[model samples]
Target: MAISTIGFDADDTLWQNETFFRLTEQRFAELLSEHGEHQVISARLLEAERRNLAFYGYGVKGFTLSMIETAVEVTNGQVSASVIGEILSFGRQMLQNPVEALPHAEETLAALSGRYNIVLITKGDLFDQERKLAQSGLGAYFNAVEIVSDKSADTYARIFSRHGDGPERAVMVGNSLKSDVVPAIRAGSWGVYVPHELTWVLEHEDAPEGDPRFRRIESLAELPALIAQMT
Candidate 1:
């Protein structure tokens, strides 16, 4: 079947997201300089994020809690209230950060909007994801919006079935091979990898070699052409 729907990931795929997280992490390291080296701090924070995913899920709120948890762990519970306050401020700053569309993001959406059913299929804190979409000014281009808790084969199957023709007729586009590409492909959708400069470590996964449904593009600019070729 021809591809009837195009699913776009919101964060680093369409606009700047992981970049803010990177900046906040640098600030986190600076705030905890006395406790440990940046590398140690970052590793501990990542460990906390991985462990806490089931509890806190993904987004700045969870990241803030992870940083605070790491600070308390590294300091043996000696982390001061002032430092905790700074970490909270970092989270708030991240929440309020301006949304900047990545190069060709808007143009790609515009080019494909009418021809295909454009769905924003992203996973994250619901409010944060909605805020980014509204601020991005690209919401109008989407035929449907899905702010999911996580991306999985089941998730894609359900979403594409509801919003478009089905996973068999949908293409999932995003930066994360783990969350965006692999699961979507497993669900019977085309997985398009558009790697971002800064991806969260947990999201890293080797591409599905020899998978005919899997495609790759340097940026969103190449997406329209690729879709045309596929059709």
Candidate 2:
């Protein structure tokens, strides 16, 4: 089927996202250095993030909370107020961080926008995602924007159906195999994996080895040609 709609993931796929998270995590390890080894602190923090996903979903606020929780845990509930405050500061800085569009992000969007129904489908804190989109200066290219809580097969099915011809004629491009590729391919859309240098560990998964609908590209600059080939 000819592709009509293209779905894009907003975080590391479009702009620098996980880099900031990784930097903040390093800061977190430094903050809790007195309580535990950096590796242990990071592991516990990841655990907290995984455990709290149901309550906090995804984004900087949840990350901040997880860091706090980890600090408290590592310190045996004796984490200083000063350290907690510093962790909160880290989240604030992340929220305020400039949204740097990945290379070819705007160019690829521009190339596809008029030719296809371009939809931004991403999951994160609603306000933060909105902020980044507004800051990106590439928002004008999208025909629609979906700030979803999560990306599952059903989520893609509903969004693609609502926004375009549906999953059979849709393509979802992103950095995560777990959230962006696997589920999207399962939903019957072509899943294009554009690996970013610093994807979150939670978002890692093996690619579908034998799926014809699955494609991989090293950068967004190649997306336009890839789509052309698909068509």
Candidate 3:
């Protein structure tokens, strides 16, 4: 089957995302610097994030909770109430930040929208994702928008089915090889990785080697020509 539908990931793929979280983590480390060093705070936070992932899912809310947990543990309950408040403030700042599109994101979407049934399948807080989409001004390009809790093989398979594409007939394009590319390929779709310069540590994974359906490009500006060649 010829490729007819294309799914794009929202964060880091279409616009800037992880940078905000990265910046907020810096403030968190500073707030609790008395308790632990930067590396220690960061490691503790990552551990807390992993433990709370299933319960809190993803987004600023989960991150905020994880930061608080890390602060308390690192300080052994010596972390002040004022410091906790500051950590929460960092999360709020991130959520309130304006959506900024990556280089050529709008152009890439514009080029593809007319040619394929474009879909946005992103995982994060539903309300936060919706806010970002509305603010992005690129939402109009997509025929469908899905704000999912997780992006797994089943999720891609189901999404592709709805958009009327199978593994051989659909493409998933995003920044993370783990969340965006690998699962889509496992479900029989072409996977395109447009690597972001900075990504969250947890989202990193190795690309599938010797996978005929997988492609990697350095920029969104190159995507139109790539799609033209693929289809």
Index of the highest-lDDT prediction: 2
* Tens-place lDDT digits, model 3, residues 1-231: 678999999999998999998888888888887878898888999999999999999999999999999988998888888888888888888889999999999999998887899999999898899999999999999999988999999999999898766656899999999999999999999999999989888889998978999999999899889888888
Which regions of candidate 1 deviate over 4 angstroms? Answer: none
TM-score of each: 0.99, 0.99, 0.98
> Superposing every Cα of model 1 onto the true structure, what RMSD results?
0.6
Clashing pairs in 3: 167-188, 167-189
Worst lDDT run of 10 residues, candidate 1, spans 121-130
TM-score of 1: 0.99
Better-scoring candidate (lDDT), 2 or 3: 2
- In model 2, which residue pairs have backbone atoms overlapping below 3 Å? none
By lDDT rank, best first, the candidates go 2, 1, 3
Write one digit per residue (lDDT tens) for candidate 2, span 1-231.
899999999998999999999999999998888888889999999999999999999999999999999888888898889998999999999999999999999989999989999999999999999999999999999999999999999999999999999999999999999999999999999999999988888988999979999999999999999999998
Summed backbone clashes in each candidate are: 0, 0, 2
TM-score of 3: 0.98
lDDT of 1 by residue, 94-203 (tens): 99999999999989999998999999988879899999999999999999999888889999999999998999999999999999999999999999999999999999
